[model samples]
Target: MIKKPPFVVLSKISDQIARLETEVAVASPTLANVYNDLQCQIDVVVANLEPLQTISGHIEIVERSMETILDFLSSSGDKSISAANVYSLLEPLHAKIHQQGEQLRKIV
Candidate 1:
């Protein structure tokens, strides 16, 4: 049996560790850089969620207003309310309410 000098064994082990680090870095490069990239991605996600938050707030208002509209439409027989009255009331709310509704549906 033969015993190699301590430095030779230590040098081989050190080289192997360096090679492992280099191979791993081929994808991510470094731990700090990878962490920074993750933080950046999270920032983007949070920024994107801002509009959803706004819509959630707006949806509350729409839901309340819609309950009123639904009540008005639901009340009485067919001939009781005039179509003209409903049209005039709904005309201004048409575009925004529809667009907001589509966005709201996507969230739900």
Candidate 2:
């Protein structure tokens, strides 16, 4: 089986995160606290990854993060979603992505 390039995977993950952000914004404007920081972090990761020519080394981390985010979104349609809850759910992933970006910077 052929694999996609890292940039394509990152782009798709970025798109998914953006879509989720928009849905959260519209569905729960009051939960801006939940998604605003996440959006910012994601923006930073995308920006860092966008110009890279050597992200293949970090694709696994990126893909795992994408899966975590997708799973959270899928199982969170209930009204139990709170600012703190979402924040906690996404914080580890955000940190991981942020760290990955830093690593990429050092490598480039």
Candidate 3:
């Protein structure tokens, strides 16, 4: 059986929550109370899902920085770029990539 991706699952769950919220507005007092409790549970699920989204974004940034660094190194040919010069050129990108990786690790 094929499983749905987490974001897709979360989106569907969010849609159902929205529908339930609408129902809550017109529900009886008892039903509305039940819906409110369910809403709190759903809120927790959504909160957990947020970290997954944040990690995905951070991974994209790390990938982009890695590509940029690769491109920079690949294009360095006859240029007598010293080690210090190369390090200086790549340090910011390296720092950004490392920061994103650290953020992802924390999220995980």
Candidate 4:
């Protein structure tokens, strides 16, 4: 049998997940559980697309970012981090960084 492209398989899985999520919404108290499970399953599948070294590098960056964020928050004294700071400033900066990283990766 001819093998389908990975995107085809992933698209089918995505459709199935959409259906499952709808079912979960109808039967469960909240959708967060379904979303978390779907995210984990997708992560497992996507891990196969990258080398272990690359995956570990990305993971290290995320780990370091979490540590740095926590450290800053802890040492900020009376200064505070607000949702506005995150949503208005940090998140957009993060998105730009990720977009640039993805563009550069595509060039390689």
Q: In order, what lDDT does every prediction score?
A: 0.65, 0.71, 0.74, 0.64
Question: Candidate 2, which segments miss by more than 4 Å at Cα?
Answer: 1-59
The positional error of residue 58 in candidate 2, measured at the CA in angstroms, is 5.7
TM-score of 3: 0.58
For residues 1-108, could you state the per-residue lDDT of candidate 1 as single tens digits?
679644444445545555565666667668546545554555555555656767767767777777788787887547577789888767656766778779867755
**Ranking of models by lDDT:** 3, 2, 1, 4
RMSD of 2: 21.5
Candidate closest to the true structure, highest lDDT:
3
Q: Which lDDT tens digits does candidate 4 get at residues 1-108?
A: 989756457657866776677777767847847665885677566555444346446656766776777687779878867877657545744765585577547644
- Residues 11-68 of candidate 3 have per-residue lDDT tens digits of 6776786687677778676776776677677777777777767767876877787787
Question: Residue-wise lDDT of candidate 2 within 13-107, one digit each (tens)?
Answer: 76776777788887787675566676677677767666565455465777787788779888778746677977876787778778778877785
Best by TM-score: 3
In TM-score terms, candidate 4 sits at: 0.34
Q: Candidate 4, which segments miss by more than 4 Å at Cα? A: 1-50, 88-108
